[model samples]
Target: MDDLTGGGAPDSTGAPLLDVFMQGTTFFDMVLTGLPSQPVPGTEIHAEGMGSCPGGIANLAIAASRLGLRTGLASTFGDDVYGDFLWRTLEQEGVDLTRSQRVADWHSPVTVSLAVHRDRAMVTHAHSSPVPLAGLVSDTPITRIGFVSLDEEPEPWVSRAKAKGAKLFGDVGWDPSGRWAPEELTGLGDLHAFLPNSTEAMAYTRTEDPRAALMSLAELVPVVVVTCGGQGSIGIDSLTSEEEWVPSLPVNAVDATGAGDVFDAAFILGTLREWPLRNRMAFGNLCAALSVQQVGGSLAAPGWGDLADWLAGVRHAAAAGSRSAAVLANSYGFVADELPSHPAVSLRRAVATIARMSDA
Candidate 1:
């Protein structure tokens, strides 16, 4: 395999010779931080800080690209300022947008998030895309992996990508209907991996224990991972008959808006690299832990540069006789060998507001 951070040159049509291909909605996310508490209705409150970025599936796209994956995104963008900002930001981050489109009169989706006490509350406004998913994936590119959301029935693109030999990874959103029907997971049989939080896993599998849920899902999908918030994550690889549980790292969380997405991206990277299942879980947990220490969603994703800096800090602390840092260094020792010698410069970071390229 090529270097972990290396990517193939784009084709003549500008489509990325991809490592990951994804199709989903992209939202303009405005995040408010340092709120003392959730605001009461009919009251005025002030936020201490704020950030803006492309959110929704863009979170995973940016996270994957920043990790040096040749990533392609297919989503509908509005012709408004928010859409313009998102398009430029993703392009600057090196994510290929050849499969995406911007509509003339459609308005961009918007999400306003309030970050408080290490958690967040959000309000979103969006409309159905003017273009359909079939339209976007009609000519899917060959890729190493495809990330998608699981639904009751698999989409045509899902079959197309699967037929092309792309290993599919699936995630699911909250079931607002509260039905949690078994039929909803029928697509699991077609996936290489399924990642869901503890609640969603239990709900779908009818198992109260996260491990049991993991086992149940593993029967269908080759790889199953259930994330249990602060407790960490549990995984079962039916192909290897390997079951592992990795604990979450201790970190001061600032905003958890896209931590899950970050974890998914990192895990996908590890899977593509064919790391041990335990290492993949640990790497995912570490990336998610680091992401929560910052604000914004997509921009807050940690690049190789961030990973290098973190490793340096841990080593320094370990040398100074810090037990916690020593333990952390030991747990993440695998990264020392995996990281590129020269990490990329000019990585994206969370900013208070969107600015012109010249101003940035």
Candidate 2:
């Protein structure tokens, strides 16, 4: 009965069914080095090389591919080094990029991350908007898509997706204060979930109590999840359903970049698998948990088995004691003691050689 698909996947009783499609957005990431200490005033810190990866769609596509989905990435990038890498990465990950485009004269957006104390701060510049607003919808294989996710965009496609029988989720990474209000976003779109962490929620709601803040969004959508570091997350699913708290897994954070995006991918994966709502939050939490254990954004995400092992008490526990930093510190100390003398120096040498080869 739908324009997208004949009856658009109706059941024997002529009701709708959920058949999802996974797609990725494109972003560029630059990884830099810095010690996790307060920078001395006016002092230039020693530096490291830039490591680039495909983010947003590319990043999520990698995860989806690993999960055995027929994933696709729909975005535009330039015919530069980053674009080449993006294409290769998607193909290697088994995602369909036939519909993905490379435009002339446009530069893929770039984000630079400064790593400090196992965390990072980023500065981003979109050389140009890679995908225009008009290019959001596609006719190819639209009927199979059970859900559509948009990050930071809440317009025309939101209503279109709803019409196509796709569940929708929107992520607000960050925004300039008052760039848009919470109600404005909530009103602008019909969403199943609105994913914004505590910091963003506080800014959007101007409320410190995360529960109250998450509840505020539920007035519009059926669910709202607000992620916090140690405090975990607050979620609400129904009008009469109680708000729930989802805890983060313990990790030895190498860099905090892309944790939220990984959470987005995991949430999608969980939802597709028909996971219980609490487990969906748990899966998202676990995905971020795996991401922070290593360096950079897309580079750090764990395969599903790795995440499952960690949660099953089969791995990572020895490294993430009491889910505490002390555990990570202790684990690092033990590993260091077993290594050859000057382990960090040797590790750096090995890495530098590889970087030079890759850049060559």
Least well predicted 10-residue stretch by lDDT in candidate 1: 1-10
For each candidate, give its TM-score against the true structure.
0.95, 0.74
* Candidate 1 lDDT score at position 114: 96
**What is candidate 1's lDDT per residue for 36-125, written digit by digit as tens?**
999999998999888999999999999999888889898999999889999999998888888889988999999999999888899899
lDDT against the true structure, per candidate, is 0.87, 0.58
lDDT, residue 327, candidate 2: 46
Pairs that collide, model 2: 1-7, 20-146, 24-57, 25-57, 36-117
- Model 2: runs farther than 4 Å from truth? 1-25, 37-42, 47-50, 130-133, 136-157, 177-180, 187-189, 239-242, 308-360
lDDT of 2 by residue, 1-360 (tens): 112112245444333332334444577776665554545788867654445666655665665545444554557777876677666656755566545678777777777777777666777787655567347434433423323443344445446656866676666655656454655464424667778878777777778777777877677677688888766677887743756787666567766777786777667665655555676677677678777766656656666455434434532555455455454344223222222232121001102111323542
Q: Each model's RMSD to truth, in Å? A: 1.8, 9.2
Poorest 10 consecutive residues of model 2 by lDDT? 343-352
Best by TM-score: 1
